[model samples]
Target: MTADTAKNFGPAFKTNWWARAGWLAGFLYAAYAANYLDVSWARFLQGLGNGAAFLAEMVPPNFSRWELLAANLIETVEIAIIASAFGILFSLPVGLLAARNLMPSWITWPFRAFIALCRSFHPVIFAILFVKAVGFGPLAGILTLIFASIGFIGKLFTEAIEEISLKPLEALRAAGAPFMSVIIYAVLPQVLNRFIGFSSYQLDANLRNSTMVGIVGAGGIGGTLFAAFQRFDYDFLAAILISIIALVMLSEFISTRIKRVFQ
Candidate 1:
């Protein structure tokens, strides 16, 4: 190689003092937080013993209350389905509007801000607010999951739209097609698979969250589970937990199959 080229390709190693200082600061802060929180080996050992005793109490699961269990499961499933449907429907337009590549800044900024606001709070917090507004019931749970779905699926959909090739879009636009027609022919087809994937995943997540929202009086199996915990009904709590696990697994399997079929 020429001397100039060799010099250009010289060793690419350098020490970053800022990175070293950042790491040191992070370690120091972590140590301080641990001390502030009173975290120690003794506390960990005590927690382990308490956890073991609790597990022992939950040895046998009881499910004699089949009617109650079935009713609550059905309600939870309904909440998830309804929320997923509405959330997906509403998110499509919002997502398209929010795609920076497709829309002008005037259009994209507001929708982007809305999506951000939706995602700023956790579902449980939303459930609390909805419960206060709508009173305790499945309605509150549905609203909570709907916003959660919109926030998550909308962001992903916007990203998917942005990543699509602009060639097809340009071709359709050149053909003097209306805006909706262009979306149908050029945009939807390209992002359909990913949209389906995101929808399915959101549905699964909604199902899990539906169960928990009930704890805050949003209405689902969570209320029952919370009651069991308060009453120290360990066997019943075990049964409820097992049922939730089974439901989550079943939803995952179904979603996987649906994705495979579409693929």
Candidate 2:
């Protein structure tokens, strides 16, 4: 090799010894941790056997509880719809405020913090808190899911807003348009499709989570399913699980239609 090339390259590119050692240490520690956790082949076999028995019992789902299931399903849908609607509406303003490229740091920071706070808890945990604050019902579930949706879509919407083309926005400002008018003409056009996408995605997620919030007595099929499980009614639990899967799939279809329509 030339002297110049050797000087530029320094020593021959040897792998870092520490990095190789770290990998080996990590692998060994993972094995040790697994052993410490008692995750043995015997435990795996026992779990598999239990799972097989559970599946066998669930083969014939009990649709006899159709009336109860239907009622809870409707409640879950209502919670999802209400939560999604409110969440989207509220997130619009919050997301706009949180977009650092659109707003000053002082304005964006607090809004971003609020979004972070909203996103910090899972829907089920939020549902429990809401239930404690507001009592058990669809109302608690709705509130919990609303917070969840806002956390999700608000952050996405803010990022979309931040990434929007500034050319149009600058032109609007150069023309002496007010902030609101500039937002209407410049910001909205660029981000509206993305906003629709985020909203639809949140709605689909909310539908699935709404059903689960009921496990904490916030209201929905989850409560019924949990009760059935406690009673060892695997057939009924299986039926509920099937219905939830169907519901989520249907919601996904509807969300796709909405996205296409908006796009």
Candidate 3:
């Protein structure tokens, strides 16, 4: 090879023996763990047969309880809508406050802390807690999803605000605009599109999670579906699963349309 080619290829071709050894050790450890856990080909074959039987039982979904299914679906949608609305509304102020470039340390720290706390727990866990506190219903689901949305969108929104062009804000300040006016004129324009994107994404995520929170008795079709599974009502479970799929697809389509319109 030419001198330049050899020089360029030298570093690229250099192997890290330590890293390769570590990977080999990890593979050996995984095998040890599998043996310790008693995982074997016999277990794998048994699982496959069980899975096949389960699939066979789920064929020919029952739609006789369409009305009940529809009602649960509606409730799930309501929970998503209400939670998303509140989350978006509340996130705006908190996100703005948490933006380090915009707000003082006193203001930013508390809001950042709150966002962190909200994000620390999963929505399903939050739903369970809320249900325990408020009793079983969609209210718990709504609150859980709201917290989830706040944690996600609020953090992103604050970062977006912080990264904005300060030149426009400086111009607004020089123009003798009040803080709120500066935010409206300088800050809003830069982050509004991103805020829209975040909100839409949160809405989509909340719709999917709302269905899941119900498995914990927070409320929604998941609760009914879980009950059906316990009773071996696979036909009903199949129907519910189909409806959920349709709902998610429809929501995804709507969210895409909304994003396009705003864009």
The C-alpha TM-scores of every prediction are 0.89, 0.89, 0.90
Instruction: Estimate, for each residue in 114-188, the C-alpha lDDT of model 3 and write its tens digit.
Output: 999999998988998999999999999999998999999999999999899999999989889999999999999
lDDT of 1 by residue, 1-263 (tens): 67787599765676788999999999999989999999988999999999999999998888989789889999999999999999999999999999998899999999999899888999999999999999999999999999999999999999999999999999989989899998999999999899999999999999999999999999889999999999999988999999999999999999999999989
- Model 3, poorest ten-residue lDDT window? 5-14
lDDT of each: 0.94, 0.93, 0.94
Q: Give per-residue CA lDDT, model 2, range 1-263, as digits (tens).
A: 68998899887987799999999999999889989998888999999999999999998998997999999999999999999999999999999999999999999999899999999878888888999999999999999988998899999999999899999999999999999999999999999998989999999999999989989999888899899999999999899999999999999998889888987
Model 1 alpha-carbon drift over 4 Å, by segment? 1-29
Where does model 3 exceed 4 Å of error? Answer: 1-26, 32-40
Model 3 accuracy (lDDT, Cα): 0.94
> What global local distance difference test value does model 2 have?
0.93
Stretches of candidate 2 above 4 Å error?
A: 1-29
